[model samples]
Target: MRGVTELLRPVWRTLPWPSLGAGSAAGLLLAGMARLYPENFDPWLALNTLRTAALAFALGLAFLLDDPARHTTATVPVPRFVRQSLRLALVAPIAALWWTATVLLIPAELRPPVGATTLEAGAACALALAGSAAWIRRSQEPEPGVSVAAGLLTVAVLAALLLPDDWELLVAVGDPGWDAAHGRWGVLLGAAVGGWLISTREPART
Candidate 1:
């Protein structure tokens, strides 16, 4: 136990606690402001704001590996997966707590279905981290969140504008597409996990 604790201390110390805190604060503020406007708030409106906040906060999560030492660390005797596993270990609980708090922040009467909405949040979070992982693998940029954020926003805008009605990912509650949209969310989450795993692999030898 002591051996494991010693191994993780360096990784934990380097984790971006500030960005995570900012993301949680931003999500909470959005949820709280929506609660203040209960008169105009509906389930659909609540879902929209909550989903947007989750995605916005995930932008911060994308910075998890944004270290000036990533390239140097990559060459260390420790395995890449070991280092990243430690990073995830440290953040997973905080992320779960943040999600729970985000859900609770919604007014009870207007809250979206927790299970379905959580699937969306999970997918969004995975996509953000996967994007950053891909960036680090390909570009080796110590800090890649800036481009990841821009790319994420671009993809979101295009998804909203270009996707046809039948295949839309974000649909209003009670719409026929709601269940189908979440079905796609499941697929998205799977793809993102796969991407992250692949991206985190050590680079090939020339």
Candidate 2:
């Protein structure tokens, strides 16, 4: 027990707790704001707003692996996967809870399709983390959050612009493309996880 705690201490210490806290607060604030006009609510509008919040929080979570002591930690006895998993394990619960709370904060009638919206969130968060991992694997920077977040946002914007109308990824519930959009989301989620796992492999020791 003590051994596990000791191993996780640095992971916890290195976590970007402030960013996580701020992101959660911002997300919930956006979620709560959805209640401001329930009578005037549109499901598509609510989804877009809530999605903004989720993306913001995911961007914050992307910073989980931004160890300021990356070089020093790499020299520690702990395996990279152990340390990375510890970082992820530490943040996972909070992320789940925050998502749940965000969903609840919006009035039920105004909420988007829960399953589909959650799928989009899952894909987005996975992409953010995977992008961070890829950046860490390729670059020597101790912190990759800024670049990761920027790139994530850029791709999101570009996709919104470039994707065909028939294949819209952010389709309204019950729209013809809704189910298809989620299928794409599933593919994205799988790809992101695969990339993260492959990139996160402990780099060949020097």
Candidate 3:
């Protein structure tokens, strides 16, 4: 436990705070826009706005694994997963608070169901992290954030444009497909988390 505690400060310094802060701010702004014209807000608008906000934040999270000192740290006594986990542990509370504030930005009477929207956000954030983890696993890039962020954005755009209705993951509330869509989201979240864990494994010494 003391070892873990000792890692906290250095790990905190290594976080991609700029991107994370930008993403959090962008998400909050987008969600808060719904409040600008409270009378114009409706369930559908609320849902899509929140979704966009979530995506914005997830884009920032895509940079979570970025480290200019990645190669240098690879030689450290501590394991990569422990370092990574420390980074996450530090950010988790901030993320929770950001999400809470974002949700509260929408008027309660017109807000979409929190549980479902939160699932979508969670899935998106997991996908971003998984992408970064996979990149680290497959390549030697010291900072993969740019490519990962671009890829994340591309995936989101393609998913929005290409995913067919039957397989849709972003259905509106009250739609016949809402429940099924969330089920798929649950699967996606699970897969992303699994992929992250698997990718965190250091390559076997050649």
The local distance difference test score of each candidate is 0.83, 0.86, 0.90
Query: Per-residue alpha-carbon lDDT of model 3 for 11-125, expressed as tens digits?
Result: 7898999999999999999988888888888889899999999999999999999999998888877787887877777888999999999999999987899999999999999
The sequence of per-residue lDDT tens digits that candidate 1 reaches over residues 1-206 is: 46456668777878877877787788889988777888888888899988888877887787787777787777667666667767877888988998898888899988888998889889888888889889988885898877887788788889989999877999887888899999998999999999999988877879
Candidate 3, residue 45: Cα displacement in angstroms equals 1.0
Which stretches of model 1 miss by more than 4 angstroms? Answer: 1-4
Ranked candidates (TM-score, high to low):
3, 2, 1
Better of 1 and 2 by lDDT: 2
Native-to-model Cα distance after best TM-score fit, residue 169 in candidate 1, in Å: 0.5
| C-alpha RMSD values across all candidates | 1.7, 1.6, 1.0
> Best candidate per lDDT, number?
3
> Per lDDT, what order, best first?
3, 2, 1
lDDT of 2 by residue, 1-206 (tens): 46457877667777999988888899999988878767766787788888988888987877878988899878777666667778889899999999999999888888888888899998999998899998998889989988898899898888888989866787778888788889999999999999989888887868
Task: Report how far off residue 202 is in candidate 3 (Å).
Answer: 1.3
Stretches of candidate 3 above 4 Å error?
Answer: none
Candidate 1, residue 56: the lDDT equals: 74
lDDT of 3 at 175: 91
Off by over 4 Å in 2: 1-4
